[model samples]
Target chain A: MKKIIAGAAYVVGDAIDTDQIIPAEHLVYSLSDAEERRYYGRYALSGVPQGQQGLPYGDRPFTAPNAFRSEYAIVVGGSNFGCGSSREHAPFALQEAGCAAVVAESYARIFYRNAVDGGFIVPFESIERLLERVRTGDLLEIDTSLGKLSNRTTGEEFLLKPLGDVADILKAGNVFEFARQAGFMPA
Target chain B: MTITEKILARRAGRDRVAPGDNIWVDVDILMTHDVCGPPTIDIFRREFGADAAPWDKEKLVIIPDHYIFTKNHHANRNVELLRAFAAEHDLPYYYDPGTPNYKGVCHMALAEEGFNLPGSLLIGTDSHTCTSGAFGMFSTGVGNTDAALIMGTGKIWLKVPETMRFVFEGSLPPYLMAKDLILQVIGDIGTDGGTYRALEFDGEAVYDLPVHERMTLTNMAIEAGGKNGIIPPDEKTFEYVRERTDRAFEPVYGDPGARCHSVRRYRVEEIEPLVAKPHSPDNRATVSEVAGTRLDRAYVGSCTGGKLEDFVAAANILRGQEVAIDTYIVPATTWIGEQLHSTRVEGDTLYEIFERSGCKLGQASCAACLGGPSDTFGRTHGSEVVISTTNRNFPGRMGSKQASVYLASPYTVAASALSGRITDPREALV
Candidate 1:
């Protein structure tokens, strides 16, 4: 696992569901087809309402207009993030758009499982309302080993909840790799 | 242990298990649909090698339902992917599109096709997979990666969730359906109140409902962030299962002194028709509180509210009445669609009532419920306000993000449709 993940923060409020992460209409493209899968990144965070797009300022799209990749690498959110649909496309879209980690007050179960098991991104729970503290474009650094996050732009740091049971899966990159190490699959 | 714990214990080959214990469970069924099926297939192939076969073919149920009515080439191609994979594997339960064996809206179809058995462990690639727990089983949604793991090994690890039982006392009123009860629970507990927990429905009122109605209560468990929702298996459950499948199974229940996270009791008579206001299923208010709120459209459909009984309830309010605003009726499955032609209200069939009421009828599928390709039937294009019986009212759920949706029971939807506003069901039913 990477010791330090540093990037621009993209922030959103509570109950940011899978629909807003990646709309259902964009779900048709094959995730396995290299060319088609790029569409996921292009539309990542596109379904957020026009007013709630990028947080404090709002109306700031996560991905550049018509671009496949996003400028923001780390996402900060309020409570109950990724709360709807079991669509793995939500996390896949974020990762495809170059997201490295998500720090939120909480997460819906399915979304948390998908992120950790798919090795799409590291999902961390912060002890405080990180979205309120971090701006959409603030520079942030997260250390997975210590569960500490620092907002370099503001020169303040926050503590993240321990990875606990999921740290084993994250350390192995994904469930498939973890299972292999555990002798459930051939290495 | 609660019923959910008991079921998980049996599946894990253990005599007893407690909440928070991580155990490897042998699942009995894994269902997938078009939207997530191709990706799951891709992951399964990539991890297990291109030529590796699933641990068991018959146990995997693939039903292509979502994005079925669209002209979008990509969406259409997904069904083809499922077809080619099913043919290659010679899977028996693949319900091919445009065939006589086609089923619609997988959650309901699972029950119709006999895959939803009592005391079994079912995991699906869709969130609403909790609907199967209505049959007194342990069922929950998992993503493609977890689903692929189950496909390759028929086993997945789980943390046993503590149970929170809701017992509905008294009799259900004529205007208040099971949808109101679930919306009420979600409203009281906030969206994540049930996180990592099992929600079990009990008491006389829940048992009095038809087996199909009980499904509506369990279908939206995910909206509450619940792991699973269940009702202890009763004679009604046994009859529903036996009528559809002869699969011999033992029905399990919680021990008399089982541990629980919480228990809530409600007297059905005190409840009124309810709706989850725009943007979230937990944003709840009584129908009277939001009555007369203008709506551009009214829809009655989806796995949660698009059953034969739901249509009957709607038709009762819509008989001899014309909807003032645009309205749509989508049956959850092909069988339910056929039933709409025979099921009657007064002298009119439910289909006839919808036709005469100026409501646009749609084919049996998950059309517009989750906002498929832009051309999907009844999809909102702009800032239209909609009152719908579908689960989930999140932004862009039915199409345009600007469009707002109020989630309500079919009776309330029908009543509101007749008035061109969010009206209480009692206004028309009484």
Candidate 2:
């Protein structure tokens, strides 16, 4: 069963790309499966983490020691989330690291589709509302049925009329499940 | 109906489609590369369970351009797996590093080899695969899993995007090129303005452009949220395909009454050298706005920037001049690198000219574009800005996340590299 975690928000600045999600140096490793995600932090930042002995790409911003960790499943971000490179491993890396949904002001069309098809619910929301929720680390619940984002911590809720069938796909799990439920067969 | 309308129509089971009608048409050519191939194939294998033979293998083309020479054992493992799949399927066109038949990059090679023809729908597990629209084909990128499913079924569904007609008039300026034109369009439309829209390049300016230059325009259309940027077939396109491909057919053109939901016009004579400043491809401005910003690097390579004309253009400017202290010149493909060596003027090849200018000509690959394959800008804390010819100046696109990338045309990039700052190529031209 898919867990729809609501509440707790972390704010990421604009244009988050695959390099931040998973560094090219670490791309040499097996990316087929999801594993220990704490290591993902070492990659997201520009400098190396203390414990990791040998990482070429410097310590990333999205690390554990820095602010914004797995405490929040909802990530509110600036425009163009997952903008560069059509690396699906990026979504896999982000999801494995405990982000359930990403609320962005806007998303690169390819990244937006990649996230939805990869099973992460990336809903487009107003930048002001997202910033407000992230500033407080507020609790927000997404009622998929009604397509609304309710910030329990601030008592502020807004309707996020979901992107084309994204709500239905989210309810059915990943694209594979959505395709199955939609009665699509491999021709 | 023409080939495009017929193919899309037959797939939709309709005679023709007017603009704005969302029809899920069958995909014609499906392509994939190494990075996405492994995961996508994993899904296909799991779904098929040893009986996975479903799609026609001939239509599938797999090319591994990124990490062509794997850095280590782990990277090598992924290469092996992608190779194994190609071998297992007996895929006719598989490009491993060892294959002499390999072309430089998939998008460039696809057009060069003639897989991308007028009126075909090409889907790839690559965002830049839309670069094939230079041939007047409709191409778009898909995720790895979608690629896998398409590989299995030999088809995937697509919404026929509403076509936007960009009618261009007037001749291109001497220093101006298609890259500048695209930056101008991106400036007007912004990034998301053309979301899910097909851009049809029309008018005299597009007609005047050489095939390669036309490619430069279509390739960056994706940067502006475009599905495909197209140019109706012309004599130049027919000549290019005739010379490049063995199997020939008559050219196809957009119908006289071709339905376009939105039609816009651009006068090329009035357009200037344009740049998309740091952060987004759509954050565009004229070269005048951001000129003279000191640049640490000036790149002239990518599916968008690297071409024979780009090399010829840059070499013409720097033939008798010295490269700026910090400038670097990297070709986008090995084939082009060899071609540059063979291009001679006044008893000197272009490579010699570049080397004499104190510019370093590096190997072909996506250098300094996506970070970490070469001398990425901001090698130290102080190195701050770069003027590059590659597309997408998003943060960390050049090197360090803190550094800024300024996008420009090949002429602008080369001129800037010689000037040690961003200078209009027209101003610097001899």
Candidate 3:
């Protein structure tokens, strides 16, 4: 686990559900096949509404070509991020798209757990004020050890709650790996 | 502690546990459907070694429900993978497709098979696993990874969640169903209100609801971010459970002074028919507010809305009338389909009533609910607007991303189908 992570932020509004993260139509692909699983990253955030003039990430698919060239390592969201469905593909798709973490005012319970258990991505809860201080493409630095987030572009800092045991799971790169290390399985 | 705490405490071998207390509890049953089963099997084999056997194969139930009926290769592969795994393990509870043991939806099948006993701890890969909570059990949904771990170990680590008690006072109105009550609650609390919390429903209204209808309340608990929605088992519950299985089990209830994080009261008399508008379950409004909203399609099925009671409600409205728009009716399970075909509403069978009304009857499965494949029967394509009895209305949840979905009760959907618009059930019922 990196003590401090710095990356570009991609901002989204409230209630971005799992369906929007990865649509159900794409759920047929088997993860056992690596080639099929990679399709998830290409389809990540493909369900997010496009051609909306005012919304963030509007008129653009999260998987659009060159979208990752901006290096969006963090996703900043409003309340109730990952609000619907229990599809782990939601976080897996985001992680596949090179998103290291998601910072939101709140998260749907299952998504929060999936992100932790699968070690797909780090889910951070912060105040709504952080939404105003951060912008898309802003240089955001997160210190997981200190529970602090700093926007280097704006020089604004926000406090995040400690990750506790979740940090350990993330460090081990998923629940299965952590289970093996913790003597839950034969290593 | 609340009933949820008590059950978890007992399962964890602790006299009592509070909210946020992490403990390992024995799982009585671990369920998986086609969409999630293959990955769970793959992961379990990967981590525990392919040659390693499951902790207890009898406790693991696999039902190939979601995409079994479809002809798509990828969708069919998931079932193949599950069938292969079940054969290798000689699992007793594998519900194979096209077999007499085939059950449709995992959640409904679990209940029909008598797996959801009182005081039990069950986990499934599907979010609606909370549907079993109607049996006075503590059940919730977990991801594939967790299901795999549970399959290998028969134990899961869980943090006990605080409880939210909803007390429904007074007799429920004739037109108001459990769907309305739950939609109203979700609308009031917002989708994330009950995040990581157990929602317990009790009161004269809940007690009066039949076990099947009570399952509807618990089924949508996940819509409000509930870890599980439970109702204390009474005579109705015992009668239902006993008919299915004679297994003696102790029912658990909240303490006389069990502390809840929040207690909310609803006067059933005041609740009218409700609908969760497009894109979000919490985006709710009165059916009257959106009345006369034209629809491209009407769907009546899912774990939340596809039960015997739901079919009866729809049949009551569609008995003599013909549908004005395209409509699809899917039973939650194969047993439910059998019930619809065998039982009569008025002089006509429920199946005949639906077919006579020009509704496309689908076989028992999660058809068009998860947007199935392109060939899925009655799946919404393009930018059509659909009024569905299914649980979710998330973007692209049913099929096309451009399709708009409005979720309501089966009665509301059936009535609306007759007029090709969103109509309040009272308009037809009264």
Candidate 4:
């Protein structure tokens, strides 16, 4: 895991589902192909309603026009982030769009598992709802080791919930690596 | 321990289990559809070596249901990918398109093909895999990485989820369907109310449902962020499984004193016909509250509502009336489609009723449910408003982010089709 992740925070409200993260239509593209996969990045959070795309102010696009990646490296969201489908494309889309980590109050189970187990993104649970506290495009820094977030824009510091047993898998880089290291499979 | 824990314990070779207990259990079945199958197969080969065979091909069921009828090259390639993988593995349970074995929509097909035996730990690569829980099994959805790991190891470690008991007292009313009961639960509990927990259905009304209807209850467990929806196996369950598959399964039951993290009860008669408004399944309102709301389209399909029984409900309402708007009737599987020809209701075949009512019937597949490709049948575009029997009303779920979708039971959707508005079924039924 990176020691520090610093970038502009893109915030959203609760129940930001998989469809909004990456719509089902874009899922037809291949995730294995480096070129084709960028569509996932291009369409990241494309399904979120125009008004809910960015926090504080509505209608803020995650990525620049026609760009494959977003400027934001960290996402601050409310509860039940990634709520709908079991699609791993949800997290993969964030990663494809250059998002390194997400800080939400809570997460849907499958999305949390996919984020952690796939090693696509570090899903950090904030101690409290951060969307209201942080604004979209607000510069923020996270100390991954300490599980702490610092709002560079507001000078507010908050503690995040520990990753627990999942951190070990995250450290190993993915579930397959962790499984092999744990002697569950042949390395 | 509840039945979910008991079933997990039996597979883990333990006497009992509880919430938050992580144990590795052997998978009786690992089901995958076209959408996730290719990626899973790719990861399996990457991790387990390109030449390594699956842990058990027979236990791996591949049904190419999603994106089957699309003209998109990528979508077609996905089905071909599944076909090639099944060919290389010689998997016995591959439901390939263009063949007699083809079955549409993985969830309902799983039940129809007898893969949904009670007490079995069935995992699929679709969120609605919980639909199989109707047969008294432990089934849930997973992503590609975990699915690939199980594909190679035949094992998965699941944290035991605390059960949330939802009981519906009194008998099911004439105008209501299982969809209404589940919708009411989601409305009460919110979407994340059951997050990381098992949502178990109980009480008189639940048991009164036929096996197919019971699936409607379990199908949307994910809509409320549930780990899985389960019901204790009873004679109705056993009889359903027995007729489907002769495979011996020792069904487990919850202890009488088993405790749940939370419990909610409702009297079926008191609940009105419900419809979840646009944007979320938990954004629910009674049908009458939203009645007269104009609708441009009405859809009745997907694993949650495309069963033979679901079609019957729709057919009953559309039997003698001309629809006021565009209505789509897509069966979940070809078998169900065939049954439409064979199953008669009120002196006419369901096919005859639907066709005569000016409804456009579609081929058996997950058409427009996940908004696959541009030309998907029944998919919405622009700002069209739709009321559908399928689960999920999140933006773009049916194709257009601009479009609005209302989730309701087949009866409500059918009745709404007649008036081009969100009308309560009681108005049409009575």
TM-scores for the candidates? 0.99, 0.89, 0.96, 0.99
The regions of model 1 sitting more than 4 angstroms off are: none
Task: Judging by lDDT, tell me the better candidate of 1 and 2.
Answer: 1
Tens-place lDDT per residue, model 3, A1-187, is 6778789887777788887788887789977687788777777777777753113436645556644322578888888888777777788888888888888988888888888988788998885446667777789999988879999998988998678757778888888777777777666
lDDT of 2 by residue, B1-430 (tens): 3334544666666777654464556667787766677777877877655558638776777776655543556556666887898888888877776667656567777777778777677888877777887787778887876676676665555556777777889887898988998888888887766666777787888888889888888888778777667777778987888788775454456667766667778888899888889867888888888888887776777778877778888888888899785656666666787888898866789888888988767666555566643333222133467777788776555556567778899888888888888888887785
- Identify the candidate with maximal DockQ: 1
Clash totals in order: 0, 11, 2, 0
Cα lDDT for residue B147, candidate 2: 74
On the 0 to 100 scale, the lDDT of residue B351 in model 4 is 97
lDDT of 4 by residue, A73-166 (tens): 9998999999999999899999999999999999999999999889999999999878899999999999999999999999999999999879
Candidate 4 lDDT, B1-430, residue by residue in tens: 8989999999988988889998888899999998899989889998999988999998999998889888899988999999998889899999989999898999988888788888889999989998888888899999999999999999887899999999899999999999999999999999999999999998999999998999999999999999999988789888777788877888878888798898888999999999999889999999999899999999999999899999999998899889999999999999999999999997799999999999999999999787878899988878999999999998889999999999999999999999999999998887
**Chain B structural similarity (TM-score) per candidate:** 0.99, 0.92, 0.98, 0.99
DockQ of each: 0.90, 0.30, 0.70, 0.84
lDDT of 2 at B395: 56
Q: Which residue window of length 10 is worst by lDDT in model 3 chain B?
A: B239-248
Off by over 4 Å in 4: none
Error of 3 at B422 (Å): 1.4
lDDT of each: 0.93, 0.68, 0.86, 0.92
> Tens digit of lDDT per residue, candidate 3, span B1-430?
7889999999999999999998879999999988888888888888788887888987888988888778899998888888888889898999999888898988888888888899889999888899999999999998888888888888888889999999999999888889999999899998888998999999999999988889989998998999999988888888778888876788988898898999999899999899999888889999999999999899999888889999999999999899999999999899999999888888999999999999999988998998978888768789999999888898888989899999899989999999999999998997
